[model samples]
Target: MAFPILATLVVLIALATLVPLSRRTTWLVRDLDFPRLQIAAVALAVLVAQLSLLDLRDYETVILLAITLACLAYQAWWIIPYTRVFPNEVKAAVSGDRDERLRILTANVLAPNHNAEGLLALIREHRPDIFVTLESDAWRQRHLDTLEDEYCHAMKCPLDNLYGMHVYSKLPLEDTAIQFLVEDDIPSMHAMIVLESGRKVRMHFLHPAPPSPTEHEESTERDAELLVVARSVADLDTPVVVAGDLNDVAWSTTTRLFRKISGLLDPRIGRGMFNTFHAGIPLFRWPLDHLFHSKHFTLAHIQRLPAFGSDHFPMLVELAYDRRHGATQEGLEADAEDEALADEKIAAEPVSEADVHEPQA
Candidate 1:
């Protein structure tokens, strides 16, 4: 009885290992990408228990061992890029003109959370040049309005839906627009920010819906919106920065493709995971809030801030634009096949607002 039960468990774990590798955008398959680390850990534990307790007399036991080992290797391949073992894509910010520096703070305030004081305190201490909030409804916007004195330039879309986003900046904003790329209600911010040195940097802030039971059942819409944005930034010859709660993990296939298509560099790569979501549960966290930038900038500072009663912890990053370094930095390149994949997602009909459900305020 024990052997049969354990074999069934092993088979289920092995099946889960293949889900994330599939290119399908179904929720179950895409959600598998979030727990690669946890899955690997569990696989290792199961392998040890099986070797010690189960007899290796049967071919079935040997096959189980082989499958577990293969799963661990596959997961490690996907995760290795985010660890220190890999080389950093964005170089460290070196001594240069300090006026070109841009500090950004992005947080998903978890709309229902009322702990604005804690987030406000962090903003007062850091005083980032640009501040962005995700899942921001009218209530969260009212609480965040206190910082308007310091951040005079503001753009906000206060909706009851969790997709609401707002941006507050101390720098001058030029040619700003609130675009609804895929869905009408889901808004994204697009603008150019003038630095202290009079140089303009293009910036975009987005918070797409995640694949979940209550909201989106599949990742098609999320993938489409991101790929569309990625295409716009792919070859732009200016300093650019994209940040917000992307609602996706750093290691997912879609994210990897986005990095390739946009030619953006991830500061977190080879630095740290900087996992921001699931702040209440240490065991179920992944990197959801992201800050990706063009090669024109070098990283000065990047760190995950403490949780302030939201489901996501805030991310603070400081970057400096240097044209000399930009010429030398290399970005991921997408081949013909990559382009085709992106086009397919973009062409798919966008998920309607009616298909989504708003969380109760």
Candidate 2:
């Protein structure tokens, strides 16, 4: 039993390494995340099994332990993105004015998560200039009314299900538009605001449903919504900021392509990775919560705020759009090819458009 279990451990360890070579293994992408945690369980089971192997010699056991140590190192590789030590290319964009600060807080109050006091408490403490909430219902809206006085500018849409979104900002909003990019009723807000110092900034708040067995079919709608926004970001002359629960990991193919195409910078690199979602357990943490900005702003600080009775941990980011005094640098990457993917027509799947035009939902 001990020898068999040792061999099984070796095989499982080897299988996990192939996650990076996902072209050959189809389920690897889906299961790679699962095995990320199970490795320790595998290690413990192997240890228990090996210890009971009477026939194994001491030297042989030592060799097995060495292999286990190597597997441990492999298990830690996923943490690279989570730790946010990405290279210069992925580093945070610099700013000319270091003193400027813009605070943003993004929270997803799980529609059923009835802990309104905790969320209200966080709002009272943070006092962020820009605030966004996901999965908001009519009840959540009522609970958030207390915030109206602080961040009086409001564009809110509350729904029964979890895709509802809202945004509140202190900056002077010029042209605020709530758009239904893919389907109707699931609205996303787009606004242009001028800072007190006359710096104009574009802000977008989105909460698109993820593609899963129950929620959405193919990723066409999600992909299209993101790509359209990416295209808009590319055309902007001034600073642009897109923050939301994209429902895709930062390292996924779509996400990398989004960053490259949008000409945006992630504050995660060189800074710490504040993994949000699954606040119930930290082991399953991923940076599903995010804040991406254009070259004009420098991220002063970013963090995943404490859980606010939701599955997704809220992300709070402080951004200042003033450029720093550095010799202007270039060589920025632009997604010239991503446009085709954005504009390409999707197979318009049959969706329940029951409330095609829901009454100001």
lDDT winner: 1
State the weakest 10-residue window (summed lDDT) of model 2. Answer: 352-361
RMSD after Cα superposition, model 1? 4.8
TM-scores of all models?
A: 0.93, 0.76
Candidate 2's C-alpha lDDT?
0.66
On TM-score, the leading prediction is 1
Displacement of residue 287 (Cα, Å) in model 2 is: 1.2
Tens-digit per-residue lDDT, 1-361, candidate 1: 5567667867877888887768888898899888988888888888887788788887888888888888888888878888998888888989477789999999999888899899999999998999999888888888889888889999999988888899999998888888787778888888889999998888889888888887688888788878777877767788888898888999888998999998999998888888898999999888999999998899899989999999999999999888787668876899999998888877675643223221111
Off by over 4 Å in 1: 56-58, 350-361
Tens digits of per-residue lDDT, candidate 2, 222-269, equal 655666677666746667788888876665545666776677777776
